[model samples]
Target chain A: MIRIKVRPFFQLKEILKEKELTIELTPDSTVLDAIEELTKRLSPSFKDAVIDKNSGKVRSYYRVLLGGRDLHQLDDLNTKLCDGDIISFFPPVAGGNRAT
Target chain B: MSGWAGRILLVDLSSGKIEVEVLSPDLKLKYLGGRGINSRLLYEGIKAGIDPLGPENLLIFGTGPLSGTLAPASRFTVTAKSPLTGILGDANCGGGFSAELKWAGYDHIVFKGAASKPVYLWIFDDQVEIRDASHLWGKTVPETEIMLKQELGDSEIQFAAIGPAGENQVGLACIIGSNYRGAARTGMGAVMGAKKLKAIAVRGTKGVKVEKPKEFFLLIEELCEKIRNSPIYPRLSVYGTPGLTTLLNERGYCSVRNLQQSGGFEEIDKIDHEALMPFFVKSKSCVGCIIHCGHFFEIKEGPYAGEKGGGIEFGAIGPFGTHCGISYAPAIFKMANLCNQYGVDVLGFSTILGFAMEWYQRGIITLDDLDGIPLEWGNYEAAIKIFYKMVKREGFGGLLGEGAVRAAAKIGRGAENYITHSKGLEWGHADIRAFKGYALNQATATRGADHLRGIPGGELLGIPPEEAQKKFGTAEAALPTSYNKARMVLHYQNLCTLADALEICKFNTEIIGQGIGIEEMGRLLETATGVAMSKETLLEVAERIYNVERAFLVREGIRRKDDAVMGKQGQEAVASGPFKGERLDPDKFNQMLDEYYQLRGWDKKTGIPTRKTLEELGLNDIAAELDNL
Candidate 1:
């Protein structure tokens, strides 16, 4: 089993600061699997932030990061997770005069 | 003025005389309109080393060839001897003001001497009048705009007016336009105040004549289509430039607390584009622009709820939000409104305030200096109160009103060390460690740390991520590593200069399309003026114009050493996020500068244009002058 740490950003942080769960996953489990497992443990409001109820899918513009690199650069939702990896989920949000 | 208005309108407020005279075509082509034109004209007209606040300094408004035409984002240029930079000063603003001036059939408006009494310039087509403006002089920008519109009985008439800051001739005063847009940097409003011109009310119904209308229209449509489809369009259209905040914070480029830190704010969620969108009531567009990037926000909840204003632009958001450690959007919105109403540059004001906060924390400044108001980071109420004091020029705020650079100089303990700035102007939000190319761009920018001068196309140009990483090593290198920046900055500067000359918006070129490159711009120029020109030939003109401006700066004693970055940029590492512990590599930066100077035919060591280089660019006269110097 692999242990993964996940941090929520933007709106996701507002919703799920609690639960703050460290989940044990299968060694080759993808980010999608981890997100699904976390949602099952979350309150209804927290679940609503990550997934669209009507589409039953992660909302477009929802950013998922694996080891600080965006998941879109990885295997989208299918990239396999590793032990002690940090994943972050952020909503579609941007501010600042300068782009990071 | 061969391809221009063929005349300059000179208004002597002291004598109330309006004189019209032809501006030589040689001068027009040499300067290439907008700030360049204004610089040359003012350099010739104003005596050297005159006080910036004195009536002897001339304040000129200039428009470019593309301004009144169907070309995009054609706006106006405000030029004066700067109270901020103490050198050649020019700030370009977007709105309909420049186009209106063009429609009034003038290429430029030059204000000379000082009015014996408060007055405003009212230009309706060919009719010009200097009317009593005593009642309007103290009004806010919005109040001035509304009152002028009501008085003129023309809802579409555009006005560029100063608020109390300008009336008081505050060193950082900006000339506000369209209620929110401004010629905001270099204290041009103080120049306006010195000239005793409260506002300029302009309306022109005369349509701009294009030499080849059909071709111009087709080209404009094609360009607009390209911009509309570009990936940048969606972000700019939806959230304006503020959309970059998340990207910057995530990448660790955000300048937090006056360049001391970087990272995404815990409260960043509250200030992102998505969060701010619900407050956006409507959109505003510049002259002949389809892409309305101007955001008008209505505050729904907060101490300043129900307050309406335009802009909370990227610069305002940084100093008012992340830099000061306040992430509340409504508070930023209120701060923006206050700056607008008071006629101050929001970026300049907020940066100075942020510096003060840092100083207070370090014990360089006490609460006594702040008039008993605690100078804490994220103190929004204190920030708001200070804006009023700055406008009124009261208490310690009077000293702070002089802006960060001068204020630091006056308080000379360790306060100067905390003031992070380059060339007297405060740094914009782009932290150089994360974006080295922008560092170079800001370092060399004519207006001192202006981002628009050269946008570092490698980062902005949309390369595939893997390829970009390999080519640039990091996002920071993307700008400096690109071989095209020498040509890119030169090209964009020319296009932007032309935009200012034509009095159009830069967004028309920058945001609406794949940008009007030298070739396209040459075509547009030819089509508009019936002056046949090749891309290479037009580029030569651009080069000549650039050299002339360089000569002016050189005459003002600006050198390679003056272009160095300030604060802990070279010494300190970015403290957080992806680029933590990384600072700009000096050797790489020097190499880039060497390459840039070599490309411009400048002396590599001094960064001055070589006589050979100047002569090659058709600046023989300027070269001769430099030799004399």
Candidate 2:
């Protein structure tokens, strides 16, 4: 088993019961597998925000980064998980900055 | 001049004269509109070393060609010699006032010289009047608007007014419009008040027309739909900017306790968007703004319940709430209302109060210094009392009204140490030390320490490297720690400059990045103005406008040294959190700045636009003026 940490940010943080978590997962588990496991542990909003219910593809605005690099850069959802890995999810967010 | 009225209303308050002059086409084409024209006029009309609060300073309201059109989020630019920063003061506010001003048949309204007594400019269609406003003087923004509306017998008359803060010539006072919206930075209201002008009330029934109505409608519809379908569109409609409180808080980049830590205090939970949900009334929007990000807040079920009003923008939360350790969103909401009503810039007031609280905690200040009112952290009542004192310019407030720089100078017991400012302007919210590109943006910003001048949101936030790479050359620009900021800063500054020149909101372009692209903007221009300009041409205009602003400051004796970095930004590390041990490296920053100056085609030594660069940009006259300097 490999232990990895996950952090949900912004709008998703408000919904997720566990914000930052370190959990043991099966060795060589792909990012998709980890996301699926975490999805079960998270609220419905996370499911709706993270995954396209029909396509199963990450939404355009959604970004999942591992070790300060995007998961898409490594291997999309198939990137192999490693021990002591850090995964961060940035949900869709916006702020009006000096527009007025 | 289908997109423009081709007219400028010049009001000489000293002579009580108003003249309608034709706007030169060459000036409009060369400078663009809105901020571009305003800055050019200020550069040419006002002299160097003039007192910012004196009658010699000119106050201008400039609207872009697209402002009164169906273009989404089009705003107006307000320009004057800033009393706070002692340089070219420019601010943009979004609302219907700008559009109405355009429809009233003018491109710019230039106010020069001080009135012999208190007066207000009244504009209705082609008729403009200087009316006695002695009775309306010394009133809050809302009160002044109400009085003007009642007297005019027109509920639709839009107003831009000042309050006691401006009447006292407080350097941080702002000119408020359509109630909550304000041209808030750099003491524009103080300039207005110094002119003995209480307000400007405009009502226009003439209506404006665009070049291609059908094409314009289609483009606007497409842009509006883009705004509606954006990922955060619904969120904006529901929570507005207050929704961002939780977002910034979670990022470990919250301007917590005035840069003490990432997220201010342990009770920071009480200051998030959820904290304000209980007090939420509804979301508000300006005229023609599809992304309605202004939430109407009311204090309900709290100590201040039943106090209903608007304006608790995201920026206000940092200063009035967490930055000062005040977690009560209700009281903070009320404070925002007070600021809006009193026509004060929340940025300056909050900085002063936060500085005072920090000094108090450090044992450098006490109740004895404040006439028995202790300025402890989270002391909302004490803050409110001080705010009122500032508006009235009473006792200690008299000194504080001079803003953080002057006040810190007067209370010279190492008080300036607490101020994280550059160019005598207070740094709002974001700790630039945590965000490197933002540090460069703030440091090099012509308007002093400000973020909107060039928003590095895409790079600071976690945008995919591929996405960021497409615009900024390399993905390295995406990191908050990377020193590859010149290109990113230049790109966004050009975008922001275009937005300001066209008087469009930056949210669709800078904040979200995908909502409105350069191609769409280019198309919008073609369809509206029949100008047939490309994105590159627009960027050229933006660059020229930037140079003019630089030359204006250069004439005022600003240089590389005056383009000073904020205090402690590059010197010290943050106490803790993700940004811990992260401060700007002096050597890296110097190299980055040198590269930035090279990219801007400015003199690296003095940070001034070179004569060759200015000449290439079709600003021959401005180039000659700077050459003379």
Candidate 3:
């Protein structure tokens, strides 16, 4: 098992009811798998805040970062997570949109 | 003329002469409205080498055809040659005032020359008057609105007024609309003050008429639905723009301590939107806007107990709190309120404040030079005191009020090295050293260093490479560090121009691309005006507007040399954050700029639109003028 920390900011933090959370997942779990675990542990509203219900993927405007690098710039949702890794979720602000 | 009020009001304040002219159809089809028409008018109205504060300058207020209709977040643009930059100057403002002006049966109002005494223009339907405003002079923004409402005997009358900052002709002055919204950049208020114009109160009863009311209404419904369903809607509606603070800070884009460090402010959370929620009263919305991204808040229990206002965007809190090293949320709010009351541009004020603090720290400016204000970082009390004196143009604030560039010139002790600016205007507090697209945007923005000119959001949004390629023609455009940002910046510049011309809120357009794209904008325009417009034609018009503004800047003597981000942004690497040790590569920046000019069909060498490009855009006269020059 690998332990990874999930940090939510802005509306996501409010929805998750915690500024930061640590959860255990299977070794080599992807960012998406961690997100699934978070949704199950926290509220389903966490999925609503960070994931697009239609695409079953992270919403484009919403941001998910692995460590300090963007998920897209790294390996996106399929990027493997290791123990002690940090994943941060940020809801969209006034900046432009991302394609779904 | 169905969507348009179809009249332009020309007022010569020096002679107190007012003339109403019929709106030209050709001009409407080309310029569209708002900033587009205003730019064309300003280009034709002023002469080269004329002082911006002199009687020769022109001040124009314009609203788009969609302004008074069901268009979402309809706004206005005030345009004049900047007393601050001495080039193309304009600012977009949202509030109740634009709709009121549109309902008064006018598309544009042009004011020229200076008044002999303090005066305010009053417009009510068909009646217009230039009234003596000696009694209203030297009033704060809210005070001016209150007095005007009392005198007009109409609580619904909307006003655009300047405060003591403008009255004193401070370079940071801005025109305040409805006491909350401000045409905040390029010193539009200083221009008004230079003309001795105190305020403009407008009211109208005639409603806007659309060509195809049913079609327009249906399109409005579709657009509103899109905006509501957008991912940006909920959070933006809740926190307004201040919500971006933490995200930007985390990304290393938010400058801290005048770019000494990027996003290393330990007290960032203390000033983010969540911190301000306890003081929030209610959500505020401009006319015809569904987002309602503004909020009224009061500092009920602190030293700023009685302080309350609206329209405090990211520009205010981010700059005052993080950039100036002030962590106290209430102090930021108090300074924001003070800026609104005094009709000062918060971005300009905070930029200069950050510059001054850094200068003092570097020993470039002494405590004696600051008039014993200490002028230290995180000193909100001293900052507040300096701000008050800035509005009054007193003591050390007198030099600071002249703007950072001029102040640096006056000091002349290598103070210029500490400034981050473009075209003599201080940059809005974002660390552009790490983001090449944003760097190019700020460097080339016609109205000095401004992010709103072309905010490159793809990099920060983490757009997928495939999607970025499909949209911007290159996957590299999605990365903030890549040199292929020219295409993205050009597209965004056109998008922003379209939003400004259409007088729609950028939140529905460039700011959140999901809300309204080019196709929807074209449909809205066609349905409202009965003009046959396609997405291609809309893009053309947007491009035309941008070129016109560029031509205006070029005529004002801007060249490739002037189009640059200077000071630390150009010289030094960002000190800390995820993108720490990153700085703009000169070669990459030049390559991006070259590509941007090439994409715009401008001369890459001179950064001017080629005659062929101008002529193709139906700006033959401008092309001829440039050729003569």
Q: Give chain B TM-scores in order.
A: 0.93, 0.98, 0.99
**Candidate 2: regions farther than 4 A off:** A1-34, A42-60, A63-90, A93-100
Taken over the whole model, the C-alpha lDDT of each candidate is 0.72, 0.79, 0.86
Off by over 4 Å in 3: A1-4, A15-17, A22-57, A80-85, A91-100
Ranking by lDDT: 3, 2, 1
RMSD of each candidate?
Answer: 5.7, 3.4, 3.1
Expressed as tens digits, the lDDT of each residue in B1-629 for candidate 3 is 68888999999999999999998998899999999999999999998889989989999999998988888746899999998888888998998888898889989999999998999999999999999999999899899999999999999999899999998899889999973889999999999999999999999988788999998888888888888877778767878888778778878778899887787578877888888778778777788888787777788877888888877788988889888898998888888888899999989999889889998999998988888899899999999989988888998787888888898899988888888899988974788887888888888888999887888767655677887899898887777778788888887888888888889888877455557878878888889888988888888998899999999999989999888998868888888887888888888788889998999999999999999999989999999999988
Where is model 1 more than 4 Å wrong at Cα?
A1-100, B1-4, B460-462, B465-504, B510-515
Residue A61 CA error for candidate 2 (Å)? 1.5
Candidate 1 structure quality by residue, lDDT tens digits, B282-377: 777787776677888897776778898896687777667887887778889988888889889888888788888888888888888889888788
* Local lDDT at B117 for model 3: 92
- What is the Cα-based lDDT of residue B393 in candidate 3? 90
For model 2, how does the per-residue alpha-carbon lDDT over B384-420 read when each residue is reduced to its tens digit? 8888888888867667778778887887887777777
- Top-TM-score structure, candidate number: 3
Ranking by TM-score: 3, 2, 1
